[model samples]
Target: MHVVEAPITITGQESRPQIRVAPPGPADRRIIDEDALYMATTTKASPVAARMARGTVVLSEDGNVFLDFTSGVGVTNTGHSHPAVVKAIQEQAAKFLHFAGTDFYYDVQSSLAKELAHAVPGTFAKKTFYTNSGTESNEAAIKIVKWSTRRPLLLAFTHAFHGRTQGTLALSSSKAVHKERFFPSMPGAFAVPYPNPYRNPFNIDGYDEPEALSDAVLSLVEDLLDAAAPASEVGAFFVEPIQGEGGYVIPPKGFFAKLKKILDGHGILMVADEVQTGFGRTGKMFAMEHFGVQPQLTTMAKAMGSGVPIGACVFDAKLDFAVSGAHSNTYGGNPIACAAGLATLRVMREEKLVERSQKMGDVLHKELEALQTEFPRIGDVRGLGLMQATEFVKDAKKTPDKDTRDRVIHEAFLRGLLLLPCGKSSIRYIPPLVVTADQIRGAMDVLRASLKAAAT
Candidate 1:
């Protein structure tokens, strides 16, 4: 299969979001109405109906051009329908569709796995188990760690979002609504405090810096393990290198290394959930690289396939399941998904998107920091690379201002910009890695105007 050398450029003003009509226009409104009647309640993320999406902008059925900062919740890392990825999908589709990788041999699956094993952090021989989504990857991690270590207990941080499935839902603590009716999740999962210097729960002395905060947090975990959960029974501590749904929270610089040390001392494993942080989203190939720690198991999805659905659990080769049928998915690592993944990885490397993300993240940090200075409501602006957020507060006291956050999002949406809210009162700005400097500035301009409009 031949790879495309350049992006498929859309000519004229159609390249970017152009608003010929306000979103939810007559046609969009009709579709939205029918969708509400037929689709599941949880299916939609915004009111605007998207008919087509390309690059950093989405074309709403109403003819509005929306700057998609959400990037389908960080899935389209290479931007929507990246030319290379599209080409790969088309070529693979022509050959064949399914030949289960779990049960049968497939060249694409092995090829993609080899690529990922090399790319994912680890000095030892590594292996990969493929799945269809982030939650599935997390479930695989849970299984691999448990089966390998013969441990019964698992640990996760508060505000952590592993997935919506029962096993991972139990690991999550981002919101009660995600688990309101689904109780008795999986057994033996415990939640611990995730150190956020901006919102310190322990309030330990000298908690201002990340190092001290992580130390205190680790101490708290040790105390809990001793007093409550036993460390010997704990299989692994699953954590997002940077918390996503919990408000785009970035832990202090030395947080992961320190946490890894404590876990190592206990003979417990560290599992990095890179579903949202993988594929150069955080300026690194994987967020764990930024932390200077290699996890025994790492779960990835989101941008792994660019826009295709694929997830994987990368772990030490030593952690493979003993039984062949112990865990397997029919659709996992199918030829098409693997082909898309291979193309996505190639595009990331060829485009040098990782370095581009770092440069763009600096741009976002500078832009958002300036906004923070101008808007006292913006209590904090934090994140690395393209994954960043602005936490709004009521005043200098730093009380969460969910109302303003909501208003700002709606206003931005009205103005043809899309932003997602996380952790109650924070707006997460995760534009596609392919986004340009001018696009960032343009989105910021829209945000600034929206903030002013919401204020009035």
Candidate 2:
């Protein structure tokens, strides 16, 4: 498998090539003003309006070429407008755009389902149900878990982000901002402590002694179950193998293993939400594989379709459930989207993108660690594979300095490097898996400069 080593060029121009433009030009300003008038201000908007994108570059209406570290909030893993994915979508569209599998049958949908059932980590036979987005997929997982176990309560973790849907919002513990206006969320959802070593509730130190922290988290789970509901009443425990929106929080080793043991003891199913960590983002095809523990159910999206809207809830086949009308979606298994997903998976395998993500992650981690050593504001630098983050702090005590983090992100954006801030005061650096080592280094340089500028 040959990885693209040369800097990506669009239309014969080198990556990050300079482009002339008038700042906040007519097109950008007009669109921004129109958007503010027509669209709800629920979601935050970036300064620039995107015109077009190729590879890891997002060309804005103002003619700025920004190296997209966000990847459309971690959706474009195969990179923007990947030729193979584009070709598949176009070819599929020529044949049929939407078949509405709830009403009709489609080969593409079945093929994608079979592929996911096989690809997701597990030795047992699995079944899959599709959805339009990550939140929908998570919502579907919740229903499946309840139906399979005949239980109502679910166990989630602190600082975990499931999604914004009413049902998912109930499980998400990231921030109040996403749930402030929304009330009366889905009930029977409980929160537990995630094994975050940095702000560990146990106050443990260092990665070398992860067992103690793991024990504390496991104990908390047991205590929560005892207080809230009985073990049999809990349907499943939803966990993001690597917390994407939660500062890329990678739990300690043996954490999941121990948690899995407890859930198994109580006959509670484990549901791994790989919405952000799956599809080679974490180097492995599935993040749960790193723990050697198979989830009874799994949810995936984001990179699964390589920027297309698609998600899946997969589960062990042995779980008793009816397919007659248990759940359905209008565009869940759209043929065109399925084709895009199949092509994305093919590209990942044939191009060895997972291996590339792992290799590049090593280089990125080392470089970021060096920056952390130099910057006092960089309190912690941690991640798995390509899903990485550097948390800003006011001092060595790890006090969250959201202002400094925001400044760093803003400065990097102005310098043609786009970054996404996650958790409280952390900047998540999740670039495309197709990104080259040099691109990673270039982005790092921009971040380093941005941190320095923001410091003063």
Candidate 3:
């Protein structure tokens, strides 16, 4: 895949983005104090503060340049401020920017919807409902599932992170921290074991033997439906093709295929939450394509708008509700966001970024695997395409070592690379699809050095 390099020019830009000044730099300290005084204390800060970003680099307020492996939490797959995306935003901003799609019809929204319908897998006629975030998309999907099946129960998997909204939060089982105080969650949501070969729920072992583990996970789903929700009462089964925030855990090869069969048997719909795994992050347009299973409804966000706030739920025509006012959002299909989405999809196809991600992922996987062999702390390295993670453990026995992983991330940050930790002790390397091999190598070298420092 050949990518045409776009020229970048930043006015009044400083030299390098990575050289941090001394601790408590006046500018950094002032902003941190202001944030502590006013902002919510929800997120854990990583010291560096982002002032600007381009390609795979984030420039911090303290004049530090960090190689961004998080990709703004997988929302910048095309890279930060890609010329194409910026041009689209600028062009759209010049014209009509935010016309409510519901109040008035817009070409950009309609065209983007058509593109998404076609891009998603399955030959069946599809329709789309746009939203502002992954959680909103999942919320729309939940409403669609209930309206289509007239069922109230939703089945999700353990260790799944759908979103933080009420609807998606009910379906999410990622961690207690995200849900501890917020619950009195939406009712009738049940969880089944997801296929994790590393910490196999069935006590089975080996990644090579994923088929049997998949079967065990499927059996638990069957039992859950039988005991938790009756066939007539279940609405949909929601799953992430490759679990994102719960760790970049990829299930067995036949997991989705067999799970689809079980859902079919119970006449339940399958909803694929491709929020983080969609848009070429998983080597394919949608992760479910890897397993050869087409979902009844698919929710996507993350890279859909190339860092802009846009998300959508694409579903089979059969699931379109007949009655009006079943589900709606004021900012569902903003024109500006649609323009961004259109530009993102066009850039991805024209540049063949999906294939680039696949090739680069192979390189990344090899490097991480080499590190795993050299560093005993890295217990597992797993991923699909660019969506990969390295799980750290005290030993091969698979005990989560959050302290070591956190230290590694901090060390990498200090050395000019940015990494994000997910699950318990796993570091996910989700760089932009536009990331070059050289950039990947640079980031991996930082990771290697950080692991060594953390291990010592």
Lowest lDDT sum, 10 consecutive residues, model 3, at 8-17
Ranking by lDDT: 1, 3, 2
lDDT of 2 at 218: 82
Cα lDDT, model 3, residue 57? 84
Candidate 2 residue spans exceeding 4 A from truth = 1-25, 204-208
TM-score of each: 0.96, 0.94, 0.94
> What residue runs in model 3 are displaced by over 4 Å at the alpha carbon?
1-17, 20-24, 204-208
| Best-fitting candidate, scored by TM-score | 1
**Top of the candidates by lDDT:** 1
Local accuracy of candidate 2 as per-residue lDDT tens digits, 132-172: 88899899999898887899998899899999988999999
The sequence of per-residue lDDT tens digits that candidate 1 reaches over residues 221-318 is 89977867898889999999999999988888888888889899999999999999999999999998997999999999989998899999999999
Model 3 over residues 204-268: C-alpha lDDT tens digits? 44534878788777777777777668867998999999888888888888889888998898899
RMSD of each: 4.6, 4.8, 5.0
**Cα lDDT, all candidates:** 0.89, 0.85, 0.86
The per-candidate count of clashes, in order, stands at 0, 0, 4
Window of ten residues with lowest summed lDDT in model 1: 7-16
